[model samples]
Target: MKKLELTAQAEDLMKSHSLQGFPNEICGFFYGKTVEGVKHVTVIKPVVNAKEGDQRRRFAIDPLDYMKAEQFVIAEGLEFLGIYHTHPLHPAIPSEHDLKQALPSFSYIILSVQPEKVVDITSWTLNDDRAFEQEEIISNRNVNTSANKAS
Candidate 1:
Protein backbone atom coordinates (compact mmCIF):
# COMPACT_ATOMS: atom_id res chain seq x y z
CA MET A 1 0.00 0.00 0.00
CA LYS A 2 1.10 3.55 -0.67
CA LYS A 3 1.67 5.98 2.17
CA LEU A 4 -0.31 9.17 2.70
CA GLU A 5 1.22 12.14 4.46
CA LEU A 6 -1.20 14.83 5.59
CA THR A 7 -0.48 18.22 7.04
CA ALA A 8 -1.57 18.92 10.60
CA GLN A 9 -3.81 21.71 9.38
CA ALA A 10 -5.51 19.46 6.84
CA GLU A 11 -6.27 16.82 9.43
CA ASP A 12 -7.50 19.41 11.89
CA LEU A 13 -9.81 20.89 9.28
CA MET A 14 -11.21 17.48 8.56
CA LYS A 15 -11.88 16.78 12.20
CA SER A 16 -13.48 20.12 12.79
CA HIS A 17 -15.68 19.83 9.72
CA SER A 18 -16.78 16.37 10.70
CA LEU A 19 -17.63 17.55 14.20
CA GLN A 20 -19.59 20.52 12.87
CA GLY A 21 -21.73 18.21 10.80
CA PHE A 22 -22.32 16.03 13.89
CA PRO A 23 -24.50 12.95 13.50
CA ASN A 24 -24.66 13.76 9.80
CA GLU A 25 -21.98 12.76 7.33
CA ILE A 26 -19.99 15.63 5.90
CA CYS A 27 -17.56 15.40 2.98
CA GLY A 28 -14.77 17.26 1.24
CA PHE A 29 -11.77 16.97 -1.06
CA PHE A 30 -8.07 16.77 -0.25
CA TYR A 31 -5.51 18.44 -2.45
CA GLY A 32 -1.87 17.45 -2.60
CA LYS A 33 1.03 16.06 -4.52
CA THR A 34 2.22 12.51 -4.95
CA VAL A 35 5.88 11.70 -5.04
CA GLU A 36 7.49 8.30 -5.27
CA GLY A 37 4.12 6.63 -4.94
CA VAL A 38 3.33 8.48 -1.69
CA LYS A 39 0.54 11.01 -1.43
CA HIS A 40 1.10 14.14 0.64
CA VAL A 41 -2.13 15.92 1.42
CA THR A 42 -1.53 19.63 1.87
CA VAL A 43 -5.05 21.02 1.97
CA ILE A 44 -8.55 19.84 2.82
CA LYS A 45 -11.62 21.57 1.40
CA PRO A 46 -15.04 21.08 2.96
CA VAL A 47 -18.02 20.82 0.60
CA VAL A 48 -21.73 20.21 0.87
CA ASN A 49 -22.97 16.68 1.38
CA ALA A 50 -25.41 16.72 -1.51
CA LYS A 51 -26.90 13.41 -0.63
CA GLU A 52 -30.58 12.74 -1.12
CA GLY A 53 -31.47 10.17 1.52
CA ASP A 54 -30.23 9.53 5.02
CA GLN A 55 -27.16 11.68 5.53
CA ARG A 56 -26.28 10.04 8.83
CA ARG A 57 -25.45 6.82 7.01
CA ARG A 58 -24.39 8.12 3.62
CA PHE A 59 -22.69 11.11 2.02
CA ALA A 60 -22.57 12.57 -1.46
CA ILE A 61 -20.66 15.61 -2.66
CA ASP A 62 -22.18 17.91 -5.20
CA PRO A 63 -20.96 17.39 -8.74
CA LEU A 64 -20.50 21.11 -9.28
CA ASP A 65 -18.45 21.26 -6.13
CA TYR A 66 -16.31 18.45 -7.43
CA MET A 67 -15.68 20.38 -10.63
CA LYS A 68 -14.90 23.52 -8.68
CA ALA A 69 -12.52 21.67 -6.42
CA GLU A 70 -10.74 20.19 -9.38
CA GLN A 71 -10.28 23.63 -10.85
CA PHE A 72 -9.11 25.03 -7.54
CA VAL A 73 -6.54 22.31 -7.03
CA ILE A 74 -5.30 22.69 -10.57
CA ALA A 75 -4.95 26.41 -10.03
CA GLU A 76 -3.03 25.72 -6.84
CA GLY A 77 -0.75 23.30 -8.73
CA LEU A 78 -1.94 20.38 -6.67
CA GLU A 79 -3.52 17.12 -7.65
CA PHE A 80 -7.08 16.15 -6.85
CA LEU A 81 -5.78 13.53 -4.51
CA GLY A 82 -9.10 12.24 -3.22
CA ILE A 83 -12.19 12.80 -1.15
CA TYR A 84 -12.80 12.58 2.59
CA HIS A 85 -16.02 11.99 4.45
CA THR A 86 -17.18 11.37 7.98
CA HIS A 87 -18.82 8.11 8.98
CA PRO A 88 -21.01 9.14 11.85
CA LEU A 89 -20.90 6.59 14.65
CA HIS A 90 -19.32 4.15 12.23
CA PRO A 91 -15.81 2.82 11.88
CA ALA A 92 -13.25 4.57 9.74
CA ILE A 93 -13.63 1.94 7.08
CA PRO A 94 -15.25 2.01 3.70
CA SER A 95 -18.76 0.64 3.53
CA GLU A 96 -20.24 -1.44 0.70
CA HIS A 97 -21.70 1.65 -0.91
CA ASP A 98 -18.32 3.28 -0.70
CA LEU A 99 -16.70 0.26 -2.25
CA LYS A 100 -19.18 0.25 -5.10
CA GLN A 101 -18.32 3.83 -6.01
CA ALA A 102 -14.68 3.83 -5.07
CA LEU A 103 -12.16 5.16 -7.56
CA PRO A 104 -9.19 3.01 -8.37
CA SER A 105 -6.36 5.52 -8.29
CA PHE A 106 -7.89 8.01 -5.89
CA SER A 107 -7.75 7.99 -2.12
CA TYR A 108 -10.78 7.69 0.11
CA ILE A 109 -10.31 9.11 3.58
CA ILE A 110 -12.83 8.13 6.22
CA LEU A 111 -13.25 9.85 9.55
CA SER A 112 -15.22 8.17 12.26
CA VAL A 113 -17.32 10.78 13.99
CA GLN A 114 -18.97 9.44 17.09
CA PRO A 115 -21.13 11.48 19.45
CA GLU A 116 -20.01 14.73 17.88
CA LYS A 117 -16.40 13.68 18.23
CA VAL A 118 -13.85 12.64 15.68
CA VAL A 119 -12.95 9.20 16.91
CA ASP A 120 -10.76 7.76 14.19
CA ILE A 121 -9.21 8.67 10.85
CA THR A 122 -8.03 6.26 8.21
CA SER A 123 -7.14 6.46 4.52
CA TRP A 124 -7.98 3.82 1.98
CA THR A 125 -7.26 2.84 -1.60
CA LEU A 126 -9.19 0.37 -3.66
CA ASN A 127 -7.48 -2.86 -4.55
CA ASP A 128 -7.52 -4.87 -7.78
CA ASP A 129 -10.05 -7.23 -6.28
CA ARG A 130 -12.45 -4.36 -5.67
CA ALA A 131 -11.93 -4.25 -1.94
CA PHE A 132 -10.82 -1.38 0.23
CA GLU A 133 -7.29 -1.63 1.61
CA GLN A 134 -6.02 0.65 4.31
CA GLU A 135 -3.26 3.07 3.43
CA GLU A 136 -0.76 4.07 6.06
CA ILE A 137 -1.15 7.75 7.02
CA ILE A 138 1.99 9.48 8.22
CA SER A 139 1.84 12.84 9.96
CA ASN A 140 4.20 14.89 7.83
CA ARG A 141 2.88 18.37 8.28
CA ASN A 142 6.24 19.97 7.70
CA VAL A 143 7.36 17.86 4.79
CA ASN A 144 5.39 19.89 2.28
CA THR A 145 7.77 22.85 2.45
CA SER A 146 9.86 21.84 -0.59
CA ALA A 147 8.20 18.62 -1.62
CA ASN A 148 5.35 20.39 -3.35
CA LYS A 149 7.52 22.17 -5.89
CA ALA A 150 7.44 19.78 -8.79
CA SER A 151 6.85 19.75 -12.50
Candidate 2:
Protein backbone atom coordinates (compact mmCIF):
# COMPACT_ATOMS: atom_id res chain seq x y z
CA MET A 1 0.00 0.00 0.00
CA LYS A 2 1.10 3.57 -0.61
CA LYS A 3 1.98 5.73 2.38
CA LEU A 4 1.57 9.40 3.34
CA GLU A 5 3.63 11.01 6.06
CA LEU A 6 1.69 13.80 7.77
CA THR A 7 3.49 16.12 10.11
CA ALA A 8 1.92 16.97 13.44
CA GLN A 9 1.63 20.63 12.53
CA ALA A 10 -0.18 19.78 9.32
CA GLU A 11 -2.62 17.57 11.17
CA ASP A 12 -3.33 20.29 13.69
CA LEU A 13 -3.92 22.87 11.04
CA MET A 14 -6.26 20.51 9.22
CA LYS A 15 -8.24 19.93 12.37
CA SER A 16 -8.52 23.61 13.07
CA HIS A 17 -9.61 24.36 9.56
CA SER A 18 -12.22 21.65 9.68
CA LEU A 19 -13.71 22.99 12.88
CA GLN A 20 -13.68 26.55 11.64
CA GLY A 21 -15.55 25.46 8.57
CA PHE A 22 -17.85 23.12 10.39
CA PRO A 23 -21.27 22.44 8.80
CA ASN A 24 -19.62 23.31 5.48
CA GLU A 25 -16.91 21.52 3.57
CA ILE A 26 -13.49 23.11 3.41
CA CYS A 27 -10.87 22.52 0.72
CA GLY A 28 -7.13 22.94 0.38
CA PHE A 29 -3.93 21.81 -1.27
CA PHE A 30 -1.17 19.68 0.18
CA TYR A 31 2.37 20.56 -0.75
CA GLY A 32 5.30 18.29 -0.09
CA LYS A 33 7.91 15.99 -1.55
CA THR A 34 7.56 12.35 -2.37
CA VAL A 35 10.54 10.28 -1.34
CA GLU A 36 10.90 6.53 -1.57
CA GLY A 37 7.27 6.21 -2.66
CA VAL A 38 5.98 8.05 0.41
CA LYS A 39 4.47 11.51 0.23
CA HIS A 40 5.55 13.79 3.04
CA VAL A 41 3.20 16.70 3.62
CA THR A 42 5.13 19.76 4.66
CA VAL A 43 2.65 22.50 3.89
CA ILE A 44 -1.09 22.94 3.51
CA LYS A 45 -2.59 25.80 1.50
CA PRO A 46 -6.23 26.38 2.32
CA VAL A 47 -8.46 27.63 -0.45
CA VAL A 48 -11.96 28.99 -0.46
CA ASN A 49 -14.76 26.52 -1.09
CA ALA A 50 -16.02 28.07 -4.28
CA LYS A 51 -18.90 25.72 -4.86
CA GLU A 52 -22.25 27.28 -5.49
CA GLY A 53 -25.43 26.77 -3.45
CA ASP A 54 -25.18 23.74 -1.17
CA GLN A 55 -21.71 23.97 0.32
CA ARG A 56 -22.67 21.57 3.09
CA ARG A 57 -22.47 18.68 0.69
CA ARG A 58 -19.86 19.79 -1.82
CA PHE A 59 -16.70 21.84 -2.38
CA ALA A 60 -15.13 23.33 -5.44
CA ILE A 61 -11.82 25.08 -5.60
CA ASP A 62 -11.87 28.01 -7.97
CA PRO A 63 -9.63 27.82 -10.99
CA LEU A 64 -7.78 30.89 -9.82
CA ASP A 65 -7.14 29.26 -6.49
CA TYR A 66 -5.71 26.23 -8.24
CA MET A 67 -3.42 28.39 -10.32
CA LYS A 68 -2.23 30.29 -7.27
CA ALA A 69 -1.67 27.07 -5.34
CA GLU A 70 0.36 25.68 -8.21
CA GLN A 71 2.44 28.80 -8.29
CA PHE A 72 3.07 28.63 -4.58
CA VAL A 73 4.05 24.99 -4.75
CA ILE A 74 6.48 25.69 -7.58
CA ALA A 75 7.98 28.65 -5.77
CA GLU A 76 8.53 26.57 -2.66
CA GLY A 77 10.11 23.73 -4.63
CA LEU A 78 7.46 21.28 -3.49
CA GLU A 79 5.25 18.84 -5.31
CA PHE A 80 1.48 19.33 -5.53
CA LEU A 81 0.86 16.16 -3.65
CA GLY A 82 -2.91 16.20 -3.41
CA ILE A 83 -6.08 17.79 -2.08
CA TYR A 84 -7.65 17.83 1.41
CA HIS A 85 -11.29 18.37 2.16
CA THR A 86 -13.79 18.04 4.96
CA HIS A 87 -16.86 15.81 4.97
CA PRO A 88 -19.13 17.62 7.34
CA LEU A 89 -21.03 15.25 9.63
CA HIS A 90 -20.02 12.32 7.48
CA PRO A 91 -17.40 9.62 7.49
CA ALA A 92 -14.06 9.91 5.78
CA ILE A 93 -15.15 7.57 3.06
CA PRO A 94 -15.29 9.09 -0.40
CA SER A 95 -18.66 9.80 -1.94
CA GLU A 96 -19.61 8.99 -5.51
CA HIS A 97 -19.12 12.64 -6.42
CA ASP A 98 -15.66 12.53 -4.95
CA LEU A 99 -14.80 9.39 -6.89
CA LYS A 100 -15.93 11.01 -10.10
CA GLN A 101 -13.79 14.08 -9.42
CA ALA A 102 -10.64 12.26 -8.36
CA LEU A 103 -7.58 12.31 -10.52
CA PRO A 104 -4.74 9.88 -10.87
CA SER A 105 -1.38 10.66 -9.24
CA PHE A 106 -3.01 12.74 -6.52
CA SER A 107 -3.94 11.81 -2.99
CA TYR A 108 -7.23 12.76 -1.42
CA ILE A 109 -7.27 13.38 2.30
CA ILE A 110 -10.76 13.45 3.74
CA LEU A 111 -11.59 14.72 7.19
CA SER A 112 -14.80 13.68 8.85
CA VAL A 113 -15.93 16.72 10.73
CA GLN A 114 -18.68 17.25 13.27
CA PRO A 115 -19.99 20.51 14.67
CA GLU A 116 -17.28 20.77 17.26
CA LYS A 117 -14.47 18.45 16.19
CA VAL A 118 -12.99 16.26 13.54
CA VAL A 119 -14.09 12.66 13.93
CA ASP A 120 -11.69 10.97 11.51
CA ILE A 121 -9.13 11.45 8.80
CA THR A 122 -8.24 9.18 5.92
CA SER A 123 -6.10 9.33 2.82
CA TRP A 124 -6.96 7.80 -0.51
CA THR A 125 -5.47 7.43 -3.94
CA LEU A 126 -6.77 6.41 -7.30
CA ASN A 127 -5.80 3.02 -8.69
CA ASP A 128 -5.05 2.13 -12.28
CA ASP A 129 -8.62 0.97 -12.61
CA ARG A 130 -9.91 4.39 -11.52
CA ALA A 131 -11.05 3.16 -8.14
CA PHE A 132 -10.29 4.66 -4.76
CA GLU A 133 -7.85 2.78 -2.56
CA GLN A 134 -6.96 3.70 1.00
CA GLU A 135 -3.43 4.80 1.77
CA GLU A 136 -1.55 4.34 5.00
CA ILE A 137 -1.13 7.57 6.96
CA ILE A 138 2.04 7.63 9.00
CA SER A 139 2.05 10.46 11.53
CA ASN A 140 5.43 12.09 11.89
CA ARG A 141 6.00 14.38 14.82
CA ASN A 142 9.09 16.02 13.39
CA VAL A 143 8.05 18.60 10.87
CA ASN A 144 10.13 18.97 7.73
CA THR A 145 12.74 21.51 8.70
CA SER A 146 13.71 22.20 5.11
CA ALA A 147 10.20 23.14 3.98
CA ASN A 148 8.77 25.86 6.18
CA LYS A 149 6.08 27.18 3.89
CA ALA A 150 2.49 27.00 5.19
CA SER A 151 -0.72 28.93 4.63
Ten residues in sequence with the least summed lDDT for candidate 1? 142-151
Over 4 Å off in model 2, which ranges?
Answer: 144-151
> Best by TM-score, which number?
2
lDDT of 1: 0.84
Q: Give per-residue CA lDDT, model 2, range 1-151, as digits (tens).
A: 9999999888888889888888999988888999999999988877889999999999998998899878977897989999999999999999999999999999999999988989899999999999999999999997752323333
Model 1 ranges off by over 4 Å: 143-151
- Clash tally, candidates in order: 0, 0
Worst 10-residue lDDT window, candidate 2: 142-151
Q: Any idea what lDDT model 2 has?
A: 0.90
Clashing pairs in 1: none
Candidate lDDT (C-alpha), each: 0.84, 0.90
* Local lDDT at 103 for model 1: 88
Go through the candidates in order and give the C-alpha RMSD of each one to the true structure. 4.5, 2.1
lDDT of 1 by residue, 48-106 (tens): 88999889988887788888877887798989889899888889989889998898889
